[model samples]
Target chain A: MDSMLSTPRAPRIAEQAAQWLEVLQRGGAEERKAFAVWLTESRRHVEEFLFMTAVDRVLEDVDPQQRIDVEHLLTQGAGKVVPLPAERAAAVSAGVDRVEPAGMRRRSVMALTALAAGCAAVAVAAWGLLAGTGWEDYSTVAGEQRTVELEDGSLVYINTLSQLQVRFSETGRDLRLLQGEAMFSVERDPLRPFRVDTGSAVIQAVGTRFNVQRRSRQTTVSVLEGAVRISTEAQTQEEGELVAGPQQSVPDSGMLQAGEEASIVVNGRITRRPIAEVARVEAWRERRLMFRADTLQDIAESFNRYNRSPRIRIEGEQIAARRFTGVFDANDPESLVAFLGAYADLAVDESGDELVVRMK
Target chain B: MQTESSKQTDGLAGTALEKYRKDLHRFLVRRLQHAEDAADLAQEVYLRLLRVENSEWVRKPQAYLYGVAAHVVFEYRMRTEKEPVTFDSEVMEQLAENPAGVQPDELGDRLGLERQLERLLGTLPPTHLAVLLLHKRDGLSYEEVARKLQLSVHTVQKYIFQAKARIRMEWQRQEAQ
Candidate 1:
């Protein structure tokens, strides 16, 4: 095998496979016909195509959190301000471009002002002081995770495909989890409460660590450290300033202590339960997914969040209902694929656009 | 155990097999080295092709047939061979690394591969790296990437193809080592 790979024909075959892959992804009917003819020309062509496919799968599986910031690298390479698109311009100036030297600090501050104006739809009057301040927006793309430290010494562990807006005013520390999941470790401040609004629910905590995951129709809150009071009513602007007061127990409000979890539905229904193991729920911070007899459907959904290609698709209801218990690296779907391949009752079809699982 | 419903579901694959059975058998006989295994390998390839959700999407049936045949042959060698294949040494190393003899977790291997790709990407020219990342990471089209980078669409495609070729070569070099 080593001898075969060392031959000059190997690199040529690899280059042909790469070109074929590109054509298959972006080309029209004529190009595909050409590819099919090329694929059938030799056995070496077939082997190289499979090998390149594996390499492309590995590229797709790379953890988005570890991806190098392309725009930042390009800017550094150019050593001059390159014109950025509008939405990206805001993120660049507010987040990554802040690390520039003193010479570019003034320009970044000006960019921050522009960002503040752009966010005026959601920002209040107090947010006008965002220029050169701690107010900012943080987000992680698909399969990406990040931990950010706020000005008040609080930590936010943002999960994949999440968006968060932080507005730290003199009166209160307000955070809005616009989408996806995030864990907030709040700093103790009796005067200002840390509140996270998930569109459907508003959770208020004081000097505690809690996780809030905003799904399509429901927001799930799991308290790991201290008690958090959740209000399922419509969010008011002044809600962020309400600290630990005597009226904490409102009619539409419920308190979840450590080792407790709650699902607040869209229509203001809160179902609270005791968490068997809080650590399992928080395992995502360590990039591990721990499942206990989870259905194949749910497992596939979780894995799909991190992988872009060869998506796991359960074809039959019986196969989808099968129970799987294991600990898998969140970014590695090959492990799951191997497990499925070993199961006697299941058949995995990996030839199509998705990895389809069916009952044998 | 083949029921009436199973037969109906296998209609498209049965047609494909009828058309390409001779070609697949001949190809397998050459690759398997054991001519006796050729017939069984063709049957395995047929079964796999039957599993495809939609055979109609396969524009070129003969090429698709050979593709499935190649996959079956590869798996046959993997199952029958005693000595570990050197090309898959990375996976073999992963299996051997676990002290508890548990199933090999792909996390460590994936991380190592990611780092290797990162280093290889760093060595690429700026234009090649940018074009590759913009298309792959940012999900931009070839036209959009060309527009953003002020390069022609054909150049963008060439850069991407070359970048992947370089990565493939790097992986081969490591495996050779």
Candidate 2:
């Protein structure tokens, strides 16, 4: 049935509505006058516009189960004449479900990659289906750090060059640390346990403070507050077993106590170490990065988190092996490098906007 | 609302500087949605203005100050990798409940009308479309559009009027078809 909006004056009325919306978005006195003219152009124009807008308002307000006819709407473009198809009516409904699957389960690694490619990951994932599963996505570009507050009130502070995802439900909070490091301050939610999936294995925590670093196939978990249970798909049965020895069942799965670190290699080998100041490992929250006796290469890489510029290349093995420790604000890395050059007798050379560290 | 000249003079003596500073900061905070960051950048703007060698070049002081703030915001966005800063869907859903008392029937009709207008807009030639977008989308005045595109005001107005009439006719034809 042709509606009231299907009348001959429909287009003019629609134009009037578009004009008003435009004026509202870009407010100007003249635009306001034009909008007023559109409104008072004719009684029919006014009535039709009101009718169409009311339908839109209803589409927005009513049952979310209503489906949208995106294909029909795409064809109509922005015209106001034809009645909204079932798809158009349900467009908002479908959009709501689009976010659920990924948000519900593990956000696909491909989803994160698409996100890095400047595609709207959340929006696209909300609108369309993602390719891969079991991969969580987390990303912070150079000189950028992000903190994501989980549904359970736990905060995850991601350091630079990091991407990860946390999928939490009544079952548990599962995280896929795709790449980079994240310090998690988990809230005390005993019912829903927290687990981080680092491709190879999972780091599960129940009311714990810890940091997880994922580099390619290798994953590291450092505990600070409460104890964390690091397990693989194999060790799920041995709930009470403290598989401490090197050649235990799920090769790398082990328990890490407070101030302890654990690394899992690709071949399922796990190593644990003691860390004194866990704050140094999770310094991204305070906007300060700390490096303890790291190689010059590691230090430079670390500095890249704070300062994106200065491609520092240590000259010889001697200089590259030299260790240093200093505190720095996230924005400034120039003085830190300069200070090193002065003390170590190394030359700080600027070659095409890049700071090179070599023998003087 | 003081004169630009007075504001410029007051900026130097740090007299009205506090008030201007607060107003500009508030303006940016609302626009950017970051209070602390806005205040920091606002301080930078004032510092730059104070340090400017030719502050008197700004005839329209409020416009110039806004222009500077806009530029600063632009530069800040440029310096950082773009993050997805989206409106909260839940909040938006909540806001959609009443939508500031906009009549439902009227809003629906307007949406349909908007769609038709957009379709009509698509049918225009590139130049006509540019004129329409600049005039309507960008809200550029006839004179401003002419200045921006290096055309006369008459030419810009003609393009706009023609574009509007053409779109109106196209709508009529589509309705008939």
Candidate 3:
């Protein structure tokens, strides 16, 4: 009787929401009127509709580059049985062979094998494998963050409004931090050194954890663990042209160890210093921003990356230059506005889309 | 008859504005995150409602009023934000409170949500997955997807609807755990 009964109430509501979603997408005055009636029938209808809409929003983030073998899937009976495409299978096999027989590679292989047993698991494994073979672009929109795990066991923590490109070859693992910030935890492969290119600077690491941020015409690299060899793009290019043998030393290049930071301008100027607060440099990974004596203008710029509405705008130079020291949630710009509003000399206007700050 | 319907529409808008103004303002404030902007937009919703041509056809003015409110908010964000708008913090908080909705930990992280989507999409039946990918990921219309898949447009719509409902139910089941 339970099996023969009608569908559960929750699923029935979900089905109704799905139908409404289709109707809403059509965008007619008549359909909208109907949707309004359906939506107001019960509070549960409204909640279910919002929930489904949220799920649809999440669907937009699915990688557009993902390629599915529709023909193969359809021929295989279109159920829980998904066969790996020919090219993806080749890629997986090629990866298994080229990867060194180290503990890390073995662990990665074991994980892949375990996932490969499930019908859908093969698709995920194939996606991960294919990402390693060629240049793939990974990016986060405004107010979003992403973590990408490369085939070589490295992990990239991409900050909001950032773009990164990754390419792995037999001899080297290369990454380009095109814009914004990224923290890389590189897996060790002495044969294929990890190198990140930021247009202005090229950071070469054998095995290290580092963060690179590209802002305007400047690129800042901070080492969290191990060491990295940093060189201007010009110097590396010149070294490649002149040096015939394995170049042991690169001219105008510097080595930075843990706790060291380097800033390279577009004009090949390099500045090195010890990081004042390593935790602050790493705070974005945890969705919190830590600022120490940072100007309001800079803080506003940072918060703007995570929020689109209620933008923070500094009205006066005095207010823009006011230094603040505190930790704030990256997603909550209102908290920052409230904090500034508490000050005696600062005025915060929350009446508009822009939270304007000025001298009282 | 036309004039009488227009007058009825005006009356409907007037009464609905008085009844739902505060509720509309609160709703806008939750989504727009600014009380002043919400207040301004609440007025705009009523103004737009008064402009509707088919006022007599609206049997439930309250539903239509809230519907117009949502449309106004959507248009305002699309004009100003210039980026894809996700669930507002209020909606997200409400969803987090519901047991059948996505967990807070999964909702807060974009990467986590993405990976969960990838895994969830993998488990879908092949035809459902193909239809979903073609429609959502590729941005193909139902007719275009039908032509490409050699299925009727109605079948395509049914597949998409079924896929979405399946994913939503599965997501709820996962979150309930």
Candidate achieving the largest DockQ:
3
> How far off is each candidate at the interface, as Cα RMSD in Å?
13.0, 20.1, 14.0
Q: How would you encode candidate 2's per-residue C-alpha lDDT over A54-114 as one tens digit per residue?
A: 2222212211111222223234433322232443335455463363322211122122222
Number of backbone-clashing residue pairs for each candidate, in the order shown: 0, 28, 0
Q: DockQ of each candidate's interface versus the true one?
A: 0.08, 0.02, 0.11
lDDT by residue (tens digit), candidate 2, B59-113: 3333334334444544565567575444344533332232222111232433455
Decoy 3 TM-score against native? 0.42
lDDT score, candidate 3, position A276: 89
lDDT for each residue of candidate 3 in A151-229, tens digit (9 for 90 to 100): 6657789999999988775445778887999999776554455788887878876446789999997999998766677
Compared with the true structure, the alpha-carbon lDDT of candidate 3 equals 0.63
> Local distance difference test, per candidate?
0.62, 0.51, 0.63
Q: Model 1 residue A108 lDDT?
A: 29
Candidate 2 chain B, poorest ten consecutive residues by summed lDDT: B1-10
Question: In model 1, which runs have C-alpha deviations exceeding 4 angstroms?
Answer: A1-135, A234-249, B1-177
Greater-TM-score candidate between 2 and 3: 3
- Model 3 per-residue lDDT tens digits across residues B1-177: 001100112343433332333333333323322323533554565465556666543654444555565556655767687876564556423322331211112223545566667777877888888878756654455655565567777777777767777776675545435
If candidate 1 were superposed on the true structure by all CA atoms, what would the RMSD be? 20.1
* Model with the higher DockQ, candidate 1 or 2: 1
